[model samples]
Target: MEEYAREPCPWRIVDDCGGAFTMGAIGGGVFQSVKGFRNAPVVSLKDSLLGFRHRLKGSANAVRLRAPQIGGSFAVWGGLFSTIDCGLVRIRGKEDPWNSITSGAMTGAVLAARSGPLAMVGSAMMGGILLALIEGFGILLTRYTTALEPRLALATYSSPDPLAPGHLQVHAR
Candidate 1:
């Protein structure tokens, strides 16, 4: 909805998918270890990824099925957060750091809705604060620039045409 054009290159999608997978694996490992899962940590992660549908390979075959769900949750979170950010920006007159925090918190609350009221509130607060800090830093670094001289908005060029019929020539600026 933003009027400003997005970059033609789409590294954001790559970042989201790759980052989600990494986080999923880490989350799976930590949770499995903490909960005392019997399978090898790697198996536990793989089993979760498999959704416990097909036969489990290695120690993870019997690992509790939650990996796939968690990964999907992350993917959803990334997508929903992006949508919310765009929506908020479009609804508002302009983009600001506030929108970043607002969208982040809203996304977090929705993701944690199933956990409980407390979780929703906690997640929302954390998400909002985290985004505020990160976005604020980014705004400072990119939006405000120190310059040696003001950038040229317009330049005038007036010169004789290289190819001309006669002494009478075209001039442009």
Candidate 2:
């Protein structure tokens, strides 16, 4: 879990390698041939669920990465307050955690200013929206995080060597 403050861009925390990983596709033929196991009902169910979970988790992670990078770059290009407002509106609509947090901070800053009654009301509405977004983001993040771990564990543990000729061998360290 190393953090580096580089240029603003979406980053993925992939396994420390620069190669490709294959995933099963439609039709049981590819999976059955690679794993050398006839597709049973239970196995098919498990594989399908695992694949769905992986796709969901990966998409969530990508969103988390891109949102911050885009927000940061926008903040740099636009004024910080404008970026904060844009972030808030996006989060309120999309329910992203980072955007919600930024929105909250911005609302607080705006409210602290001695402004008119309408401005205060607008700030309060923004704050309420930010809260809702935060809650939604929390629920989504938890669901996706939980789903990812088991799917990844299954994939890691169930590695079948396609080159080998016989039954599946669980590799031992």
Alpha-carbon TM-score of each model against the true structure: 0.49, 0.30
Enumerate clash totals for all models, in the order shown.
Answer: 2, 0
Candidate 1 residues 8-63, lDDT tens each?
22454456656776687568655654454344334345466664422233224322
Show pairs that collide, candidate 2.
Answer: none
After superposition, candidate 2 runs with Cα above 4 Å error: 1-114, 156-160, 163-173
lDDT of 2 by residue, 16-101 (tens): 01111111112222333333322222323558887655555554554444444444443332343334645464457643455545
Return the lDDT, model 2, position 70.
Answer: 44
Candidate 1 residue runs with Cα over 4 Å from true position: 1-70, 143-173
RMSD per candidate (Å) reads 12.4, 19.5
